[model samples]
Every structure is written in structure tokens, then in C-alpha cells.
Target: MSSFFGAFRRRLLTPPVSETTMEVRGFHVKNAEAKQRLEYIGEVFLKGYAYAVEAGSPAEAEELLETVPRDMRGFAYEGAGMGAAVYDSLPGHGGRLQGLLAGRGRDHDYMIYVGIGWAMARLPKPLWPDIRSTDPLLRWLALDGYGFHQAYFKTAAYVRTPHVQHPFRWRGGHNHYTANAIDQGIGRALWFVGGTDPDVVTDLIRAYPEHRHSDLYAGAGLACAYAGSVGEDELARFVEGAGEHRWALAQGSAFATEARIKAGTVIDHTHLAARVVCGTTAEGAAQVCRDTRPRTPEAAGPFPAYEAWRHDIAAQLASSSLVSKGADQ
Candidate 1:
């Protein structure tokens, strides 16, 4: 009965599934495969989200999410993160999100944090402070999630309008780097927005101010690796298109490989992107991510820890002997 009540409440609160469709969103259609794959991600994500909201415990949610095929299981966890965030924001609920991060959900930590950002787009502004994370470095992923939501849902303002949202005074006034984090999310969404067309996606990014290109390219590289809808050739072409920003692209690819590997969700697509973008195997690229990560992120830089960490990864990727090895192949 308690489970039933929780789920009932969620059903009323959840966004309609159609909202994720390209047709509903008026997004580009690159191919039937990309179309179906994108829609399927949305369906699976909502399923995970609903389960997280309805399940009696985070463990129960994990059990149900694990039932999703291994390739997509992390996405379910990502959705569950969004669900947990939204659930915790409700009047009767509190601390479930913190509990989620503390328990079995820890493995999919990156996705979960990104999911919490999705909840930021849905919930009232007053409740924003309650959405918390134990890891300072990863808390920015919430902004990434927020950017994805705005781009995915509010296409006119965020994507087509080419209007980047103003940096909010979020996460206890970490104002300086907030927009950069949001731009990363926007870049990821462009992969979907252009139907994974390297030409179209590159053009879209080119439209943005030159200063924003690096973060956007990195975000695109992460999506190209993680939620792939393109082939090896397309991946290489995106690298070529990125030009001076290729290092940032590799950095983003490494980040995706690291996230997928950490969540135990590495797949063929993950390997493909890592190889093309980072010029290394998934494991190798993930290692690069770990190798360059800021051990003490809070004190790591004049540019802030997260940005500094990303720059270090990009520098390593750009200088590595492996750079362009796979792209040449």
C-alpha cells in the first residue's frame, strides 16, 4: 500500500513520455536507427525514474533497474537519480537522494548527479539547495543535467534560439564556473539535436561564440562516446571538424569512457568513441581520466578545480603519443 501510494504520487508528477520524442520536440531526424535509439533511451530513462520514485528502497530501485539490458542499465540509474531528486523534493519526502548516493547507487555516481540536475529544471527554485552531493568535483554534473533538460525540452531558448541561459547562483554561489558546466551539457544535447550528423553538429557549435567552442566540443565528444548514434567514420569526422578543440573533445570522450567504465556499463559504442576521440582503448582512456583527475579539486587551480581538471585531461590527450592513432586508422 505504501509503494502504491508513492508510485501514484509519482505518476501524477512525472513528465509525459511523448515529451522525449523528436517529433514532439521538433528535433532533426538523422536516421531511423538514431531516431529509435534516442526514443528508446528516453523510454528507458523514464522507466528507471518511475521505478526509483515508486520503489520501497534504493536497493529495490537498483534491483528493478538492473533488469534493463546492461548497455542501458546506467541510463536507468541516471533516470533514477532524477527520480530520487524529484522524490526527495516533495513535501513528505526528504533525504532519499542522500541515501541513494550513499548506498548501491554510488556505482553510477556520475549519472546520478547529472540526473539530480534534471530535477533542478523541474522542481521549484526554493528547493534547489536541498539537492546536494558529497563530492564537490561531481556536483557540477547537476549543471550538466540542467543544461541537457533545457536544450532537450526548451529547444527554442536553449538550442535554436542559441540562447545560453544565464548562470544561476547555484551550489552555494559557485558562480564563476557555472556557465562552463552548463555549456558542457548544451554541447552534449547538440549531439541529439543534430541527429548525430557531424556536419550539422559542428555548424551548430560554430554558431556559438568562439569562447564556448571548447566546452561544447567536449560535451559532444562525451555524447558521441556514451550515447552513440553514429559510426566510426562519423566519429573521426567530428574530430576533424573540432579542429583546435580536438583535445577538449578527447577529454570529453575520456570522461564518458571513465563514467561508463566506472558504472560497469562499457559497451562497443563506448570503445569506439574512446578510440576515435582519445586514440586509446576504453580502459586506456578511462585511465587517462583517472590519471589527470584533481586529487584535491577544491584547491587545484586559478581556473577552479573542475575546469582545471578538464584542462589537464585535454592537455594530456593532446600531447599523448596515442593522439590520432585511431583516427588515422
Candidate 2:
């Protein structure tokens, strides 16, 4: 099919798959299981990318994306979103990402937002397609996606040396939540970069300022929810080790739950991660995210609506934890 060659050409526009491995990146591995798990995530994303690029239309791509294993389907959609963005960014091409977003892609909007960030990382700002119509609240996820790309591909600058700088302040120069969103993404990458070992991931987060621990832990918690590399017992241990940031971790887990539920990609592991990391069932944790989510069209704050939503969720979890502690006492 002509689509196959198109997909191949688009893929050629990016780095090869092997470059994503820990060995290729000279990063440490927690264990074989962790490496295998993260690598699978990449493979799924690439499959989605290929499908989107190869398809004649978004509807065709959706059919292909739906064929991915149920457990990893969301990642494929994320990849498809990334692929669309890359195509749209081409000098002669445009509207592919916009078309996907407006079509069946709406079901997986959150991932697409993050996926677009991946394209943003690879392409110049001028070349970036106009996606201003994206929700004001969720748009920050593009930065989160960008952060993950940087940390995943440029480990030296984002992880080990860590000298990332934001392009500008947000909310009319009132806050730098953009950087926070990106750090949250970096935190997610830390999950992969640290080989899914809780100790190594926590240590890497600890190396940052105490203030950033919450966002970092939040990202890590989301990654844990996505195709978890470990089981409930280990995830429970992660909760225990989270210390003061437990609420933030739970909040991130809850966000992941909401995203999966919205995309209709919820799996058994999604429930397990929600229960262990969030101290609630997947539906319950998702409800917490929903309840804390701002209702207004705009969230007014020193923080953006997205970060504000994050703060509220963490607060809700912190409050629930306090109540549970009191009952136990």
C-alpha cells in the first residue's frame, strides 16, 4: 500500500527504535522486567505512529489503532497523535493533526495533547502547527509531553545534568507553571530512565529541589499506572515510600485513571495502580480527579487551570489520608 511507504518515510524522519533503550542511552537498568516493560511502551507507540501515517484518513487510522492490544491501546493513540503532528509539521503538509484531533482522536484527546509535545520537541516552533484551539486547561500537557521527550532522548541535560530552561513565563508573566508541567513530564520519564526501580526513581527526584518533588512524583505515579512494570505489592511499597508526597502521587495516579477512563482503555493494572497509589478503586480515584477538577471555563490562579486541578486533587487525597489516619488512631 502507498500508506506503508508514507509511514516508512515519516518514520525515517525520526530516530531509530534502538536509540530508546537504556543500553543505547547509557542509562542504568533496574531489572530485565523494567527494561522490557518500557521498551514495549515504545513499540506500541511506534505501531500507532505507523498506522496513523500509513492510513488514508483519521478514520482509517482509528481502525488500525483499535487493533492494538487492549492494554496498550492508549499508548498507540498517543503515538498516532505524535505521528500526525510530525506530518503536519512537514514544510509542505498541514492539517493532519488538526483533522485527527477533530475526528475520532477526540476520544483520546489527553494523550494527543502530550503527543503533540513530542513533535514540538523534535520540530522548530515556527514549523509547529497551529493548535491554539486546544483546551486552555489541558494544553499544558504539550509541555509535559515535551518534557518526557527531552528526558527520554536527552538524558544528560534533563536527568543527570538537568539544565532545562522554560521558553517563557505563563499567565501574563505571573508564574512559571510551564516549567512545572515539563518537570512533571520529566518525572514520568524518570520512571523509564530509572528503569522503574522505585529506589532509583525516588533518588533521582530527590536530587531536585524539595519543591519539585511533588510534580516529579506526580509524573512517576502516572507512569506507574500506565502498563505498570510491577504488581500491587510493589506499588503499595511505592506508596509507603512516597512520604510527604503521597498525596501528589495519588493525584497523578488519579489523573492517569481519568485519562484511561476517558479513552475507554482502562485495564486491570490501571485499577491496581489506582488502588495502591491512590488508596481507592480506579473509578473512585477518577472521581476524585473529576471532583477536584475546576468547573469554570477558565481556572484563575498564579497556577494554570491544569496545575490548579493537580493541586486540588492532591489536597483531596491529603485530606482523605488525614481522615483515614485519624480513624486508625
Candidate 3:
């Protein structure tokens, strides 16, 4: 129990980048019992993500779930099991760590989400209905499955809108559902949500602090600016400074779905394919993508058009920044 409390205590010491980490007060479980406590906490994190989406903003969502019960929660183990299944079926070493640590800690929300996203994306969408709502343990399966679909579709539209001439069509080279499902699964499971959401997770890069991934800061900074969470100048500085890591890795980075469907003959570029398949408006295809894409620590820089969009965001920020500065002055 001491070990568990020690670990939990250490986690509590770490603050979320955008908000104060929730206080784990009155937590008196001993080390021998700490393992169970940690698993239960993991479910809260999943619940938090679900509630966060439902709340439509990260901050408000966090507040709404602060008082939710944390007893008898243990999806981390199930998440690990599902994650391993997905990893085994897919290529590459992505998501393996996340799979192993699915139910370990609050920090592992990303991994759990990733695995869920991967599973949701890969598995047919119809299977995402509430299957285990009454049971705490089974409830996670539904949360994991549906939450991934919701988040992936949100991001997919953002990436596809400009490139896709039609809307969220999903035909032709689009395959938006299939394509997005694959990318989100692969990404969340192996990359972005490895142990934590990129927005909150830090310290586990190939190197050290101060030199952390620019995309992570930039993306979060942009969200901060847009959501009125941070100043425009700061957002601009972060976005601009982060652009130094930009790299153009040829255009068509084919994903697994296309690779498998076409059997390695025709590389289906996710961007172009998504564009072709999406509906007429960015909001169509069930609003498959959000207006913005969060930058991962590993993204090569914003996409070309995304870079241009940042300029627009920065310009808006500039106007707001000037007003703010003038008021201060």
C-alpha cells in the first residue's frame, strides 16, 4: 500500500499542463491495496475523457467529473488486453507499451484511449453502442470503443476538409470511416496516447526538458489561444517557434488500411483519400473531424495548409493581443 500511495502521491505532484492536476485527497489505501486503487483511478480517467467530450471543452469537462465515484473501476486490465489484441493484428511496434500499461495509472489514459481508438477505428462502427453500461468493468469496453470513434471522426474532418473536394463522402478514394479508423487506432494506441495525452503528458521524449517536442507545445498553445485560455502573443510565439521542426516527408504517407486493402500495389494517401471521401461540408460525415488537429510531439511541423491556417489564427491573435497590450499600456 505504501508503494501504491507513493506512486499515486508522485502522480499527484505532477500538474496537468493546462490545469491543476486533481487532488487525490483522503486517499488512504495502503501499498498492498494501492494497485486496486490505481486501477480504479484509471476508469475515472476514461470517464473524464468521455465526460470531457460530452461537455464540449476540456476544462468544463474536468470540473463536471471531479466528484464522480472512483470505486470498483478497473478497465486498465481490459484495456491492456484489448490493446494487445490490436497490436498483434496490426503491423509495427506501436501501442505495445500502452497495451501493457492500460490500467496502471492516471497517466495511462492516453494509452487506454489509444487502444480504444484503435479498436473502435478498426472494428465496425455499429458495435459501439452501450454494451456494458450497467456493469462497471464492462462499461469500459463501450467507452473505449465509442470514445475512439468520436475523437477520430472529429480529427478526420479537420484533415480532410481542405483536400477533399466533396464533403465527408467516404466513397471513391475517401474511405473516411475505414481510413480514419485505422489512423486513429494506430496513432492513439502507439503514438499520441502512449502513456498520456500529448496535451498533458511530458518528460518521456527521446531527449530532455526545454527541448521537448514543438508540436505538443504548439498544438496546446493554439488550443489555449482559441479557447481563450492563453494570450495571443504567447500562442503566436509558441506556434512560430514550434514551426522550426517542420519537415516535408514526401506527400503520400500511406497508412495500413490502404496498404492492406490495396495489398501494397496502390498507396492510399490518407489525406487525399479522406478528402475524396468526405461529405460536402466539414461538418458532414457526422462531423468526422474537428476544426483543428492537435499536434503530436512527433508530427513533422504543421501541414502546409495548416501552417497557413495558423497565420490566420495568429492574425486574429495579433488583433486581440494588440487590444490586450493597449489596455495594459
Candidate 4:
């Protein structure tokens, strides 16, 4: 009895082990050096995000963002934007986000603008009553959102719009290279506005010409998977409204859904969005990701794995038809 009690006491005192590991499975970086660099940036981003959320200031976030090497600045900026969004509930959040955007010019990696979209998507609706009021910031963000659609899938549209200039100017001169980064931000923001007022999401979809509808709906689908606020009925409505763009929407949703799952950010509704948008299980979408993702051996640059994954995912999604069929089913 003494031994039994002692064993039980030890078991109670023992720390429970967690299954979650720091190593990511579906996603991979290039070489060990690149992996280390990516990991360091990720660490810095978490630190900065935590600091901003805790202290309710963007200064520390900006400081840390600037420290990221220029080559990886796009990814870092998106992370910073996400961090800013996490702290959007804090006072003066708008001013800080606007300041960050002001400091970083429009030409700064388009992904950074997408990051801004991420922050905006997560922001409260009351704070942005004039999204359609021709405010320069709002206009630029809207244009940037459109630009992201064009650049990612290599769709036929002028990159420069009346409100914004060329949004996707990579040093390497490949707009497709930055597609995933661009969509991540846009999709997140789409969900943001969609949750606050599905009308806005609808308006934005209609705001663009019929030719651009696919990209618009695709971004909305991505948001549907990420934004927790959107309900099943709303998703169904959006899918029904997508019309010819339904496939694009499902494709985008699948990409983001797979990414969310791989990143370990899968919420209860993540898979639901995929089911509604793509007519497939989350596991099926992930299988597509695994099957379609480009291996590191076929990639180039410091972050080959990531770039390859995004490139292949974009290509596959561009031609994917799962969403349209899913909605019909």
C-alpha cells in the first residue's frame, strides 16, 4: 500500500508530455543554413508578437521587423502584421499599423501589404467605417488586394491600378514567386471583413470586374478557412454567390486550409471551411498538398522548400475545380 501510494504520488507530480513538436512536417525550408535563418526569424517574430500583445506597442514590433534580412523581409512583415492584428484590441493600434505602413513604402514587398491586410482583417469593424470611402490607405489596400490576385496566379490583368502602382516587383522579377505571401494576407483580411459584414465581402467581389472575379472569390475562400468568425451558413451563401469563381474560391481555401493544418493553427472550423468550399475532407486537401508540393531538390534560392511549396500549390490551385463541384454536391 505504501509503494502503491508512492507510485501514484510520483505519477501525479510527473509533468505531462506534449505531442506538439517545434519541427514542422508538411512545410520545409531549403538547406540547414536557410532552415536556421528561417527558424531565427520565426523566433524573433514570436518574441515581437508577444511583446506587442503584452506591451500594446508597435515600436518593438517594427524594430524587430527591421532586423530581418531584406531577403526574408516579406515573410517577417506578414508575421509582424499578424502580431499587430493579435494586439489590435489594444489602444492606438490603428495609428501604429498605419505608421508602420507609412514608414514602409508601397513598393516594399507586396507581401508586406498583404500583412497589412491581415491586420485589417482581424481589426474590429467599427474602427474602419470608411473602407469604401476613398481613403488613400484603404484604397491602396484594396488595390493591393486586387494586385495580389493578378500576380499570384499570373492572371491577365494590369498590375498597376489607378489607386496603386506596380504592387508585385520582386528583385528576381518573378511575380509568381510571391504569390502565397500575397494570398495569405489577402485571404486573412477577406475573412476579417467577411465576418464583420459579409456584405463588404460581397461588395468587394462585385467591385472588381467579372474578369477579376476568380481572384476575388479565391481570396474570400482562403479567408473563410482562417477567419473563425464566419459561420457555416455564411460560408454556404458565399459559395453560392461565387458562381463561375467557385472553383477558384475552393482552390484558395484548400491552400490556406492545408497551410493552417500544417502550421498547427487548425481550429474546429478549419476543416469545415474546406468541406464547404472544396467538397473534400481536410485530410484529402493535405494529401493533395503532399502529393503536389515540390520537393527541395527541384527548388532554388535560400528558401527553396517554402518557395517550391507555394509555387506548386498556386499552380495546382489555379486549375483546381473541387470547389465548384463541392458546392453542387
Best by TM-score: 1
Candidate 4 global lDDT? 0.48
Q: Of 1 and 3, which scores higher on lDDT?
A: 1
Summarize candidate 2's per-residue lDDT along 1-329 as a digit string, tens digits: 33666766656765567876778877668778878878878888877777767677777778788888877888888888788888877667667777777876787888888888888888777776464666777777787888898988988888987544546433322256777888889999888888887877888888877787888899999888875787777788788778989888888888899989987889888889987888778888888887877776365666667777888888887777678779999
lDDT of 4 by residue, 114-165 (tens): 4444344444545432333223222333333434333322222322121222
**Inter-residue clash pairs, candidate 1:** none
**Tens-digit lDDT track of model 3 for 1-329:** 12453234324332232221112321222233332433344454444433322332233333444345322122332243333434333333243323233323233232343344434444454533222222222222223333333332343332222232222222212233333223222222211221222222222211222332332233232112111222234323323433432110000111111211221222222222222221111122112212222243122432333333333333333344366568889
Go through the candidates in order and give each one's C-alpha lDDT. 0.83, 0.79, 0.29, 0.48
| Cα shift from native, residue 324, model 4 (Å) | 12
> How many backbone clashes are present in model 4?
0
Q: Using lDDT, rank the candidates from best to worst.
A: 1, 2, 4, 3
Deviating ranges (above 4 Å) for candidate 4: 1-168, 175-188, 194-196, 296-329
RMSD of 4: 18.2
Residue 120 in model 3: lDDT:
44
Off by over 4 Å in 3: 1-212, 220-307
* Candidate 3 positional error at 310, Å: 3.8
Question: lDDT of model 2 at residue 195?
Answer: 84
| Cα-lDDT of candidate 1 | 0.83
